[model samples]
Target: MLKAQQSTEMERLLMAWILLQNFDVQVSRFVDLISFLMADCRYQQMMKWIGNIHETLSQLFIDASPLDHTTCRMAL
Candidate 1:
């Protein structure tokens, strides 16, 4: 499923990093996913993608944004 994201290209990876930031969830699950992806042999080909994921996570922690963000709303 993730194979199609096969690119270290910075521009695309940057966009992906931003999206990941806005949607980050459980820390363990997120880290586990990135760790698994990093261990793959094909990973070197997509280093930027994986690296940006890590970078986004790092920035999230460093930014010190307050929790309790805008409340969720459901209407469907």
Candidate 2:
């Protein structure tokens, strides 16, 4: 009976160790996925900001063109 109890305990300990290893791997993968997602999110935000700046600059140039043409005409 004592040997049986020891065997059972050993099995339980082995199972616990396997579970802990698997849990560690799962946690590591989860952290890597989160880091990749965060980097991708930051990249998306930066692209969006760059797009907004480009649009603003384009609009400014569009708005200034007529004024530039009128000034050139007046000067001539």
User: Residue 40 CA error for candidate 2 (Å)?
Assistant: 13
lDDT of 2 by residue, 44-76 (tens): 764465455335434543554533544322332
- Which residue runs of candidate 2 sit more than 4 Å off their true CA positions? 1-42, 66-76
Q: Total clashes, candidate 2?
A: 0
lDDT score for residue 74 of model 2: 37
The runs of at least 3 residues in candidate 1 whose Cα sits more than 4 Å from the true structure, single-residue gaps closed, are 1-24, 41-43, 65-76
User: In model 1, what lDDT does residue 27 have?
Assistant: 48
Query: Tell me, what's the RMSD of every candidate?
Result: 8.6, 26.1
Clashing pairs in 1: none
Point to the candidate with the largest lDDT: 1
Query: Tens-digit lDDT track for model 1 on 1-76?
Result: 4545455434454554554565446444555656655665254657666866666665554454445222211110
Model 1 alpha-carbon miss at residue 76, Å: 26
